[model samples]
Target: MKTYHIRFYENRWIYYCISLAVVLVGLICNVIFGTRLDIQFTGGAVLSYSYSGEIETQKVERAVESSLGRDASVSVNKNVRSAESGQVSNNVTISLAGTNSITPADQTAVLKALNKAYPNEKFESLKMDSVNPSMGQSFFLKCIVAVLIAFLLLNLYIAARFRKIGGMAAGFFAIFALLHDVAMVYFTFIIFRMPLDDNFIAVVLTILGYSLNDTIVIYDRIRENRRLMGPKTPYRVLVNTSINQTFTRSINTAICTFLAIATVFVVGSVYQLNSVV
Candidate 1:
């Protein structure tokens, strides 16, 4: 069998340089655009309404801002209806993000303001959802705690299960790789000016598991190779050999994952949130 042999450690600096460039660019974007926390994390209200005909989102934003005396984001979409139904409705979703909740009086005022601005549009409230500031803070902290617990538990497991083949070192590098994945995800969100919300927490935790699973597969291969090649083998050679053995499997796994993600993105784009009401 023709086996591949590549010295990953020898080219470590190239990877390090690439990672540093990513961080530098993220920092520059942060200075220019800044980061935003979603209402799910920051605490506030999301008031979604169905409006008649065409109306500018900017008008809705201005009306809400005037009513509440705080900045609000308004998203307007037309032709939103379920795939099963022929009926469609134009909607305006207003997001009030802050450390304070929107009060009932304020909600009433915003509705009045919108109706007054566009009497022809006939605005009607579909739903109102609010998150307490303290509750949001608590939830955010819980997500952090969950991630920390996952890391700690995974490390202990790896160290116990792979002790014959530098388990502690394997676990450390695995965690380090997971952190790199997390940082990249965070920076991607910040650079795109996306809100760090529940979706952010969900994605991070999901990536943690996925990345750890991939790491464990290579570590398993390494443990098997170490036993076959005997303990006297050089560590670099052992790792490179095991990695070469697992390279094809890893590439296949990544390709499948990418295709799954692409499928979801394409479906979402095609539907244009018609199911969202």
Candidate 2:
């Protein structure tokens, strides 16, 4: 495609600026309201149990809350059980704020509460998992250090490779693109109210890798154009030209990779693969 064909408007920088502004807003929200932590990040007990009988979701929640003597979260695992005709099946996942030892008395209380709600229902306790904030903090600190190191290396590499276009600006702009994708992923998770966990970190890393690859390809072509087509070309024109030249290759690559990841995501979600999500 020609440069004009690919061009959306006279100013491409506007798109970049808009993306930066959006990310800045998300960062501000993250700073103010804070991240929605998962059970692992906060002191909590995750109870996975199965229930069989006619029961409503609200009744299950009420039972868990009454048993805990505090507000606890309850989620249904529809993937675990098949709702055959006339049969009500569900796997209840209860998350309590405190990560104390689950005593036999606690289990009995919960069972009794659930029994009160649905006389014919039965509660089968399966497993429990717990984590503390200190552990989460330690993991978060490591991730921060790793991201910083990666960004530093990216800066040095881009600066060395693209001496023109003010290496500092190009490198920073590449980082800006990376921050854009990361912020978008976080915003998506927040909008969905999904638990913020290690999967989010993985998504951020994937975005960084993708953005870095795109920036390097565009910068490489720009450098080549400057050498062959002459540096007299305007900066905007040069960027647009390089982008048009590499558009097909870059798009094909991203599409193929995205298809593979999308497949994994779909299958993972369908099969309830927590590791992939």
Candidate 3:
């Protein structure tokens, strides 16, 4: 196939401006509207209740709001299965997010109030995730540290392995691209008002692995060209040539992987969120 190539750095200023705009918009959204956090990061209680009969989710929300005197998030987790049918049964799970009181009695009171409202429904306190505000801040800081450490270690490994090529500078550019992907995902969630829960972290890590794999493939081609074509070939041409040669493979791999993830994500969203999660 004839290859199409686009220079990434020839108009470096354009990418820089686009990157800046993305980051700024993401920051503004995060600061103003903020991400919808799940029960994990901000310590809260998740109440999973299954009603024998179908119930309107809004009704449950209203009940929880009136009783607790605060709005609580309510969602359905339809994963419960019927023993007889060997299939998923009709079940509605309610998740209430709030900062639990420090004392055991206070926590019990919250649970008791929920039980009092719906005596017939099955109730399960799957887990309690509560961290003090100070602790939560520390945890956020640690997450950032972990990502930085991973980047540094991976960069070092790549630099050492490809020292015959451009060495650390090439590795650094690849790492920079990985960072771009991470930042893009972060900003996407912020602008879309999507929740940045534990899943977001998993997505970021997955992207890092993906982006690095592609970078290595391209770098290997670049190294091969440098050896066979000689140093007289400008690095820019070599880079562009390498990108064109391997672009199909990279794109095919990425497309297949994305399709698989999309299938799983769709299924999870439609039917198996609780069990899958």
- In candidate 3, which residue ranges exceed 4 Å CA deviation? 11-14, 52-71, 82-89, 102-149, 266-273
Clashing pairs in 2: none
Q: lDDT tens string, model 1, 200-221?
A: 8878888887788878888898
Estimated TM-score for each candidate: 0.78, 0.76, 0.72
Please tell me which predicted candidate would have the highest lDDT against the true structure. Answer: 1
The global Cα lDDT (0 to 1) of model 1 is 0.83
RMSD of each: 4.1, 4.8, 5.0
lDDT for each candidate structure: 0.83, 0.75, 0.72
Residue 55 in model 3: shift from native, Å?
5.6
Better of 1 and 2 by TM-score: 1
How many clashing pairs per prediction, in order?
Answer: 0, 0, 0
lDDT of 2 by residue, 115-219 (tens): 788777577776777757788768878988998888888888888778676687778888777776777888767655566867777777787787778888888
TM-score of 2: 0.76
Alpha-carbon deviation at 260 in model 3, angstroms: 1.5
